[model samples]
Target: MMLLDSIGSVFSVIALKPIIMLMFFVIFLASIGKSIGVRRMYVNMLVRIFEYGRQNIESVRKLQYSNLNSSDVDEVALTTKELSTDSIDQSSNSAKINNVTKLNGVVTQMVNGDTNNGNSVISRVESLILLPGVENCPSKNRDSNQQDEIETLEFNLSNCLDYVKSGMEAIIEDEVTSRFEAEELKNWNLLTRTNRHYEFISLRLTVIWVIGFFIRYVILMPCRVFICFVGVVNCVVGFAIVGLIPNKKLRIMANDYVFKHTFRIFCRSLSAVIRFHSREYKPKNCGFCVANHTTPIDVAILSTDHSYSLIGQRHGGFLGILQRALARASPHIWFERAEAKDRMAVARRLKEHVSDPTNPPILIFPEGTCINNTSVMQFKKGSFEVGGVIYPVAIKYDARFGDAFWNSSRFSMLQYLYMMMTSWAIVCDVWYLPPMTRNEDESAIDFANRVKSVIAKQGGLVDLVWDGQLKRMKPKKEWKEKQQEEFTKRLKGE
Candidate 1:
């Protein structure tokens, strides 16, 4: 009976009680208060945080504090004030280098979200992310599988466009300024917004949390105590139910359930003012799945439709730590793009995950990275090699969702969501085309182009499609498949 009562207390605490948590918070604040001038600093900090994203994001609701905080955001309207950086001042030196330099090496660092000192920032800013195989990448060749020597394409500009633009004003100095504006305009396809939305939502979340805590501690705790009293009485009368059998899987499942339900309801409720058609993909099983990286939310957008194991790039610090937890509980694989040694190992690990039965299909962004969602970039080979039956999909958000593009710059997720509501409705047509198989002779680029064609045809926006030799080969995949089957039959002497 005593044990049952004690166990009951824990359940009571979890359900509605908040006294324990409140007491903890009080003690925490009291301790912090003792620091010299801490209270003043803290209050000011909180107020400034609230003021940060006042007008930036469309709807600020979720309280993701760890990723970004209030003062960290600039809520003032994003002005036409040109993005000032130290690198542009140094670009004169950058342009002088006429020899072939590996730009991706620099861009990859930026893509990995790592800033290389202050100088490389300008050179590393990549507005466009090529699909995996469209360009010759070292990541694939690391594997034992032999790859034919291939050439990669440069930026889609005819000349240098790096120039100084002052206050929404074009300060053109020859061809350099034209290229610079074009570069900005190109990436502008992926709408850019200030991070004020995050600030707004963080403040909201702080408010909700405080109210919920107070209600739990003041009202719910007393109620739970009464329930525990009942549990005590029942113990003498019958077999007292004791502690719950700790089930990690069940806990993980419950967390995911609440997490998802909360996200949906949150989005739907918030969507009352915002304009996104928010939903999840309902999957019958868990396994590896891949999509073209149009926007970074391709995973979240798809996951909304179905709950599946997600594979994504790794982040360090708090973001990475949470990811590590999620990855451990669910199916997730991380690839270090910078690790020359571990790159192949990463691919192998992905292959293993794809082969797992319990894992919701492993997902990959064949484009490897993202650009403006106008067209699909060259597909990476990773998906085609392991994901034999390539599920080609093209996600097209409304033009209003323009600011929703994922790029190298740091974008607050909440701010982007808010933009969707005010500026546009988020909509994407996820076409489940027939799966594909690999061939012995065909290159990865060929497969990517074939899939790209399928996506482009469905979206009705291939007019400016970048055609390469891979797409030029008529019936390339079909021809390759026929030859493969014939070769197999001949080998079997059938």
Candidate 2:
């Protein structure tokens, strides 16, 4: 009994020591805003492994294809021989037709016995043959007019076909639906998110996958969970302390400090590697900082570098706890669902927030919903209408590392966080663009679009005009009506 007790005690000490040490190490790094290149080294090693796996997979695939090609070659030769025979037969038929045409000058003339009659016969035959790129030469003015009418009908039909093709494409892969899903990676990163089933491709890959699974689930997840717990506790405690301070200026300063450091700790929990560019244009006091939304983590990602007052609909559960914690320390605006839907009230709150210079810049994702990192969708005009200096920030994630988009409808916050913790790392680049303000003549919607275009251009993302809210609701009736109007115009040759 004594030996067992001693052994268990030793094992607990060995396990707890490293965990405690890692907690301190992470906290220290977060406080200093420094990285020791551990994540970079891990990423470099992963790159090498991915490259090695890709090369081996290619070699195996080539060997497989080569074997297939050997059998395919004989089948292809046989098919080619048969095709040649059919082509010869077709050529002979054409030759016979050409000979008859030369003898009679026109094939229809041989059957009709008069040139005028042959013209009518040819027209009738052409009407029966509805082949593309085939045209009948008309001898009379009336026949020519009829031919022109037929061509006009075809042109109109082709215009409608264009709409059909686009509709089909949308049905298969619509912009809104795709934006709500994970962005596809060009290469497999040894993650099971891909449809390639790359793990089973080779024995080496299988072994690597098993090892990676152990590292991600057994080693990294527990550490990340522990760090996340520490971060939350620190945030709650830090905010509670900050709330106790009575002096406004000192409280603001304390709040900013606590927010930035707490978020940095949260960032480290996910092993996030964020690179900020053009820091000179970061959001200032009493300004509206607009960004493209990809995930709920965007707040943490941005807060790691600069503190901003968040504005959004009040959420519940884990998100609610964090929201309440943040609200206690700062002047964050959280609207109930009913209040959020009142644009005038929401704008009023925003205007009040920005009017106060003491408040931090109000961080707003005018998109209102998360989009896959591939594109910037339509920006709501409410924030732009609030009349404040807009600081546009563009955030682009490296999906090769891990996808950061949050599909709230499909996965809950906890599920999304689990996936994030297990991912290799959240690597992204953030660009802070110059400050923008609405032009005197520019409407709020136009100003919003202008800002969105700038962010999309900076981030190398597609600029789209579709509302992000389409993820939850169907497109507005006005949009469908506009499309119908355009289709009618096209049909009328306008």
Candidate 3:
């Protein structure tokens, strides 16, 4: 009796207590403070850093030889100002060539002179003279009017140095402006405003979450556990029924009924409103059916309506056990992807499975992994190689109700199911597109892409060209280069 009381007290502390709700607000307030205080400090620091860089660039541009006479500087400045407006645009090609040669001679003279600590600066100024037209100018025009050429060269050289300085300053100014604008835009986007609607509903949603916490833990959790138990029992019964059936045809029929009917119930248990569109355009017998994979629940949604053989990787845990039950009751192929080093063997199996008239249409999620329902990733070519009609299936979930994307990297199976089961309803739209066949002499990859494009279009999802491997980790540079070379070789029939 004492132990029972202690257990009840613990349960009450977790479910009925307000401590968890208070913690949520506490963390939220702490985050608000940090965002306002620490965020501004960091942004100010960034602005200062950019300002410092701008100052350095300005100082470099303003650099002048300290030992040069004031009169020489004024003459250079006056000549540069006069020539600046129309020197390049209006000057004849011959005049420009003469100026360039004279400028080169001046640079040589500066190199041999006793210019103090401005040697590095002089070198940089020399580099700036090698502009587009300066390098290719002909030598025939180099002898025109030596006195005028000397004055023009000095003016132009000074003008070139000023131009380089202004260019650097302009670049730094643009970069700083862009950086600040980007930071401002980022801050604006990050600022979540609480409008009248949110203000009114914030308290209500908080109340709901608090109430939901208790209801989820106390009542719904137990019911979900019971439902899971029942589902496991139903699967076991399904396997046993398939095994006990005598005749081959009768067994297939019975297995179909059990698997389809049980999964339909399981989907309903999670409040999933599974709807199929264009049912009349079903896959032909002994044909291939490809679908966009959204979540593991796709299996249930598909099985409820269509009697098809699923081909997928052998998973573990509850999904694995479910796979085993599925294999027993139907002609499903659960291949171990790690052990699948022989592509030809897998292709042969797929071909054989779809070719058998007695077997149901082979269903393959050629995407090879679950995508977030926002985009259709590239399809694998293995299933597309089978010579027959291909039915493309596009699956989309209504995230307006609740997100149905199961990110395996973040959530475990049970955690994902908890979120799904607690949500309003898992709504899905499955479109069975019109059947298509490979064009004359089309490669498997091309055929797969063509089918994938159609499905992406119909489903209103982004069509990704990536091979689906980049989602795991970016490939190394050398490996990517090698792959490119190999692809080039294949295209050339090397």
Candidate 4:
């Protein structure tokens, strides 16, 4: 009896009491629809910690550089010279001739300088003199020499230099592959692997990291997990009950209420701080709501304010349960893998969904895959083809708080949630732009690209023409062939 009493006391102190208190706190916040400045305070503290860490790192780096000697500097200079000499030696004779020709042209241009009209007068004069002589030459020998030169079609090694530069750029960092990876941060966010070796820069920083680890894993993780569990349970049970209602109006009301509050609970689980701008342009009535894709949590973040009918492929496991629950109360379109691939069928369904006056605006990520929040990839034309108002929303996350990007190819859903719950916070801004409609003369692809540019501009993200699907698939044969054709045109001076 004494031992049992001791175990009960320990359990109540460590787990039971905190769980009950946290549950009540979360419920109170959800009911009131306001936060009590806790998140703000936490963010301020993080800012101070990050500043301190930055200063310490700078000091350490300065100290290290101060300790470096003259010998090391001389050695680095000598090594650079040797590398340059080696490169020069390895070049072929043709490449050397090409380089010499380029050097000579550059020197000549510099010596002649530019005209007051900002044109290269010498170059123009030389071209005119050469052209007339070729066209109006009377000598048979000169004409024969010119004909031979034209027929030879001498291959300049310099022509292929552009390919070398492009190859080197790809080897260093290509645009498509980098968009699917994590966004690089300018400062460490107290998360592991977010930055390189910042935690070990100073003993003080290391101690702070240890404390943050305890706070995240020991305290915050448990509270977040519990809140998330409650939210999921509420979603499943609430939607199931709402589905049984016979009245469509009441059912929609109940569904909206449940969805908004439940997703608000989810936002709390990640301690997400979302600032929405231009709420006047928020989606209303049935239309297409398009946004840049960053992560799966974008749904929860947006749903916290407005109830949207989600569109996606049928998922299983945890996502499957949520999808099944959502479908019960709302009209969400979940397609089979084969059906999703049928563009005609997908477009038909989208048109049908928007045609109805009663349906909520369908939220679609037209990029069709998650980008790293640093850029917006090509938007698929299916949604734009359905013919409706396009409500473009731009979502940009602050990486100093947390990395909200979901690299689905690298991490599973569960693994992503683990990182989110452990993160300091998920901070982001959402901009709801004015509704756009396709012009009568504009094609579906053109309209889609237009909306994509709007969102990318609003979010300050790089607007890329590359498909996000390139993360998994190779470049299309047609795309490669088109590039080859362009290169040939350049070679022929066409």
Note the Cα lDDT for every prediction shown: 0.42, 0.80, 0.61, 0.79
The TM-scores of all predictions, comma-separated, are 0.42, 0.84, 0.57, 0.82
- Write one digit per residue (lDDT tens) for candidate 1, span 278-319: 223223343334455555556545544445555666777534
| Worst window of 10 by summed lDDT in candidate 2 | 125-134
What is the lDDT for 460 in model 2?
95
Clashes of each: 32, 0, 0, 0
Candidate 3: misplaced stretches above 4 Å?
1-201, 208-221, 476-479, 482-494
lDDT winner: 2
Ranking by TM-score: 2, 4, 3, 1
Model 1 alpha-carbon miss at residue 284, Å = 6.8
- In candidate 3, which residue pairs get closer than 3 Å at backbone N, Cα or C atoms, i.e. clash? none
Candidate 1 ranges beyond 4 A from true positions: 1-288, 317-322, 410-425, 439-441, 461-494
Q: Work out candidate 2's RMSD over C-alphas.
A: 13.2
Runs of candidate 2 exceeding 4 Å displacement? 77-159, 338-341
Residue lDDT tens for model 2, 1-494:
99999999999999899888977898889987888999888877888988887787676665555555454445545544555564567765566555544543432332322343111112222122211111221111335555455446533566556456555655555656767778876457888875367788789989998999899998889889988998899888999999999999999999989999999999998989889999999999999999999999999999999999999988999999898899888988888756636766777888888889999999999998999888999898888887989999999999877889888998999999999999988999999999999999999988998999999999999887778888778777766665666556546644
TM accuracy, model 1: 0.42
lDDT, candidate 3, 1-494, per-residue tens? 99999999999998745654643333343323222243235334434543443344333323423334566556545555556555455555456455555554444433332223211222232222212122232121334463245434432334334335535643544211221111111111111120112112234434543554575456545454555556667787777779677798998788767776666556644545656899988776788888887788888778777677877887898788888887876777777777857566778877888778878888888888777776777788888777888999888886533467666767898888877666544667889999999998999988998999999998998776544544455644754465445434333433
Where is model 1 poorest over a 10-residue stretch in terms of lDDT? 179-188
lDDT of 2: 0.80
In the range 1-494, model 4's lDDT, one tens digit per residue, is 99999999998789777677867797669745788888878888889988887777667766665555666545555544555564555555446555555544543433332212211112211111111122233122334554465346655666555556555655655667878777766556678957567777689889999999999999889889988999999899999999999999999998889989889998999988889999999998789889999999999999988999999878888889999999999999888755636666777778888888889999999898899898899998889887889999999998888889998888889999999999999999999999999999999988998999999999999887788888888877766665666556435644
